[model samples]
Target chain A: MPHISLPDHLPGITGLLEFSQNTAAPIRELTQILLRGDNSLTQGERELIATVVSHNNECRFCTSAHTAAADLLLGESETCEMVKYDLDNAPVSDKMKALLTIAKMVQKSGKSVSPEAITNAKAQGATDIEIHDTVLIAALFCLYNRYVDGLASVTPDDSSFYQYLGERIVNHGYTRLPQGYDHLKNS
Target chain B: MAYIKLPDNAAGMRGLMAFRPHLAPHLGAFTEGILCIEDGLTKAEREIIGTLVSKLNDCQLCEGVHGAVAACYLDDNEVLIEQIKEDYKKAPISDKLKALLNIATSVQKGGKYVSESQIQRARDLGATDIEIHDTVIIAATFCFFNRYLDGLGIDPIQDSEIFRQRGRMIAKGLGYAPKK
Candidate 1:
């Protein structure tokens, strides 16, 4: 049960956003721009960054949601799990590992993302845009994770729900998610 | 002189954003939207939330700069800003604002920290849902900013006058647009 009443059947932030459209607009707009907008990082990589931060923050809803998105785009779930479980042990590239390391630091404290980490990411071929997006993705997810968990929104017991939503997200994206809320209601 | 070499003139978070001009514009726009755009909270109230959260995060640079901005928006209400930082509950502010600040502090701790009672209190004190939402976003965003600036090892300005000047510019709706 959420701390406050949200629209019936809506899960996590979806319910929270539906509760107030005014607050929802900017947040949705920002999410679209950051996650799906033009950037050097692929949608998978960006979603992975979000997943890593969400995991670190211990937000199950966000972690599961973004993990599904990452799984779809990357064509594998193991990569996200690897990044989530242990970045170093994950079989991602040197560059990706470096970026994930920076994301983890951001989850701890923005100040914790050190000069050495940036240097390491750069050395591994992370561009300025990539670095910027990585930070924003990490930062944005913190907001999102807090928004969902803070409200005490319902986390669906079924894992397939996330994967189904993920496929829908990979096709249409955040703007469509709100409309899908109504469809979810009808269904 | 931190993780990345920043321009001498680019101080604090400005310096970090300056390191990447491409993303700088978006951040500038977001700040403008959050603080300058006419919305649920007055510009001064938004600044108050920003300043208070920065103070809570122990981010001197953000607190000082936003305090200057809040001072400008509040018509040089320096004492009020000081009061808010020291103890907003007893501070001589409207109950609505105090309630919003209470919510902001909850955001500062963690999202899960905000309670239904707090929301109900803000609503009871004439705070609309939009106002409460904006306060939470402002507080949460500052956490990101404070951490970003401090994470990058950005330091506060040595001169208070600089903050005053910037505050005036921001108050005049100059916003965070990066100059060419």
Candidate 2:
């Protein structure tokens, strides 16, 4: 059971977000801009970064949700799994590998991210904006992971729910939730 | 000095936010939403939560910055702020605040460390649902801020007076708005 009463139909961050629309507005906007907005990094690549951070944090809901989104965006499922299991040999480019390295370090602790990681990322052609986004994405997921799990929000065990969520995220992005979900709030 | 080439005028997270213009406004709005909006928890209590989380994360910049904000709301009660930082459990705050701070401590350790009993204890002390929710959000958000500033190796400003001045502005409703 969740620590606070939440909508049963919506699970994970979605349900929690619905519970508080005041904070949700800005959080939704920020996530939309970070993951879906115009940038050198593709939406799929940003989703991949979110997946890596969630995976490292052991947040099942976030990991599964973003992994599904990344899979659909990238048009493949194996890469997300491979990145989770062993990023070193994952089929991603060396640049992605370098960026993932920094993301993982940020997951451990901000201080654990060494200067060499930044140097390596730049060497791999990661621009200043790319490096900055990677760090922010990683840090943001930490907040998400903790928020979801700290409240003990609902985490659906059904894989089909994630598949639907994946499609929704890929098509609609993060700003707006599906209609009719409003009635579920405060219920 | 930060590892990245951030703006020279802005300090700490301000410089980082300045580096990326696109994302700064939303982030600022989010900060204002959580900290400035006084619904259940007072603004001072919320800032205390942020200051405590930053201190636990060892982010000196955030601790001092937010600590100053909390102090400003408390009528310059720097001593009380220090007491809360040192140990909110023994501090002269309300039982409700103590319960909330306990939850904040668990959150700083890890997400799952927040036990059901902790929630029960807080609720027992008259903390509403929104209060508990905002506490967790505030604690979690500071983790984001701390890591963002520290991961880039931004140096913390040393002078206490600087934070005091900034605190006055923030308490006066400057909030997290990006500097023009």
Estimated TM-score for each candidate: 0.86, 0.96
Q: How accurate is chain B of model 2, given as a TM-score from 0 to 1?
A: 0.97
Q: Per-residue lDDT of B1-180 in model 2, one digit per residue for the tens?
A: 576789889988778877997888889989998999789999999999999999999999999999999999999999999999998989999999999999998888778889999999999999999999999999999989888989888988999999999999999878886656
Best by TM-score: 2
- Give all candidates' CA lDDT scores: 0.80, 0.90
Q: Per-residue CA lDDT of candidate 1, range A43-131, in tens?
A: 99889989998888888888888899999999988899988987898978899898889888888777678889989999999876677
Tell me candidate 1's interface RMSD: 3.0
TM-score of 2: 0.96
lDDT of 2 at B21: 79
Per DockQ, the best of the predicted structures is: 2
Clash pairs, candidate 1, are A111-B151, A115-B3
TM-score (C-alpha) between model 1 and the true structure: 0.86
List candidate 1 stretches off by more than 4 Å. A1-6, A15-30, A37-40, A176-181, B5-8, B13-26, B37-40, B176-180
